[model samples]
Target: MKNTPSTQGRAYSRRDFLKLSGLTALSIGGMTVLTACGPSTETKDSGATDAKSDTASSFGEGGKLRVGMEVAYPPYNWQTSEATDDTIPVEGLDGAYADGIDIFVAKKVAAAFGLEAVAVKLAWSGLIEALNAGQIDCIIAGMTPTDERKQSIDFSDPYFIGHYGLLVKKDSPYASATSFADFAGASVLGQKDTLLDTVIDEIDGVNHMTPVDSVPAQLSHVNQGACDAITYNVENRGGLLAANPDLVAIQFDGSYQLFPDEVSCNVGLKKGQDDVLKKVNDAIAAMGADDSTWETIIARQPA
Candidate 1:
């Protein structure tokens, strides 16, 4: 299989693609429960030492921290064959698969705790279930620590901060819209089960659009006049705009709103995995002290 960039402009090696598709098939063939209910606790610290010890013991022999992520997300995780000095292969992904900033950070955490870092690619909606079932030790998929997610699992301190933005056609009237409320009557959509979908509801009288199956598909919808715009993280929006010159990214200006500072993206662990959570949190804190580390990681990928 050849390593090629995805239609979305992210590199995806053929090996990585086959591996991901195979895993999905295996999961379905076994009738594996792909989705499950998650907790809603907003402020539980489960990444303590005891939890880590327990998780380590559960995984047996080698102290490997199995991490689940969506390898398709660039600047965080993506597929690439031309291994650069910084590219690291995802554990289960094949054909020179590697990840971005988040994977780099996960590597630091794994090293700090003397554990092998293993990456597992899973759908965003199924991440929590995978963690709870021990399919993966933790989730490092750039998932935001939200109040709704806290009930199902615990999260480490935020490692990277980002906010949402709207992606629209360059010449679209909505291109100049700033706030979430600005799209009052415009049709908007986002990835299913993501904050983007739920966040749109905050806008009064907005014509909420149905969620799409993937980021590329959502963008396609906007391109085909199926939707006015799609909302997503600024980092991803940058990648999208870079890949597709016709799309315009609408920055929130001062209108961008996140769930306060407390709710940020972090590594997620199962409810009882306190020890593992603490190890990850401490590693993140250490990483935070070095601004250059993040700068270098960000500079390696497209946009």
Candidate 2:
């Protein structure tokens, strides 16, 4: 049976029920009890219906691929209602929906595999945990493949490469400083537990401010003169710069020792799901070698 719009949105399936029954049997013997109490004609009909439902609910049968992401991040993921017939509402974001680089790219990747794209909103830090828990099949959030994360999950080929930058107030002296060393005596802030925060700590004489809860908060501290600047990726900083006129991005050319040139961000999957990982990676590679996929996703955002 073809998946209609209504059926596509719901998460019910006969296969899922069967899997549930099997698991229930192992834990509670519920299936055995139901079978013993269901020898009637009605039971047989119900069983057949359930079996057909399970077969229809299989992932590949409906041509759907489940993807998880943090819709709060812009340029990568965000909500919109403009609906050019190109975007769809996320599974559980209420009136909000996700679009942008990640969603667009995810749609393309899903299409390449003959799968329908379904977006599942997830917290940034919880993405990996959700993947391992089977809550999500893959994470298309704009996540960097850090060494720490590599130990738990496998990442796809780098689809986008971004550089780090400093966001500061328009009038701050450090606004014009291009190199990390130039902030030797200035106060800096960044999102807590992120690469930006760690990198800022390496600057000599730099009074690093307490880590902020979010990127916007880090930008707010700089705007309020709480810190000289906030270190973050150019993509995120770009959004802040566009939203706050008083903020300026200080691009460090070759001055601030390059952190790493090939910081490739890609989809993440649960470890040992090599088959699914290979399919996703191959889809990314076949879409074209150009980074326009990233640009296209980013272009859908406000800035």
Candidate 3:
């Protein structure tokens, strides 16, 4: 399969499909559940985590720019034990390196800021918490900037635009499904702290299972029949389908419009940091304009 960037721009609002009211209700009702199982609570200062407030200091004191990511999402961010020209050593993990589109974006952002790029491996759920705790400088994970997330951390202009899709077992009833409404009552799973999980409610009567900690867990649930399907994006298609041939990605018809914000992945930083944010945005814009380099990076991803 030839990998190429999507020509579609983010045209829908994240708030339009997944209403903020519903999200707020979910957050409030699921507060206890999230606190117990969501991201770590370790923070640097209780009062310093506001996403709307901007701090004036630049990232890292000198030339060191520490960028954090789950290092688990594929073709976008993933682990590589061996050293390669494209690999960046995981800051604190011995013998492991980070590679993928996120690393590419981080390197460019670092260069724009005149800093050395350092990849900080983190758990998906702990990314925001670590940033708040000052453990890492910025989050370059394939994270979408939802309205809810914007309250706690500011985000740069999208660096990578993704398209949504569902992964289901080839033998499952949903394999032939054509739309979101076709999966009513079918169990589905998504990763925690992601719009993927929240979008499950859009299916109306889907038996939305409890969110998991990682993509591997979601894959296990579906492959084992614990769930009928899982939510993912276009960039994930090659790696995911290759890893499990028994599963296939469902490309819904054109009638289905996705929440644009869900497809827009950006660099996340603590509130303020206008200078750093501008630099990051500029880097992303520059990268986006250069289709050749972007295509080459995508083509070189591990299958």
- Output the number of the lDDT-best candidate: 3
C-alpha TM-scores of all predictions: 0.73, 0.72, 0.76
- lDDT string, candidate 1, 105-178, tens digits: 77788788787676666667778876776667788877876667778988777666555557789888887876
RMSD of 1: 13.6
- Model 3 Cα displacement at 103 (Å)? 0.6
Regions more than 4 Å wrong, model 1 = 1-57, 178-182, 252-263, 288-291
Q: How many backbone clashes does candidate 3 have?
A: 3
- For each of the candidates, the C-alpha root-mean-square deviation to the true structure, in angstroms, is 13.6, 18.6, 10.5
User: Model 2 lDDT vs. the true structure?
Assistant: 0.58
TM-score preference between candidates 2 and 3, better one: 3
Total backbone collisions for each predicted model: 15, 5, 3
- C-alpha local distance difference test of each model: 0.59, 0.58, 0.66
Pairwise lDDT winner, candidates 1 and 2 = 1
Model 1, global lDDT: 0.59
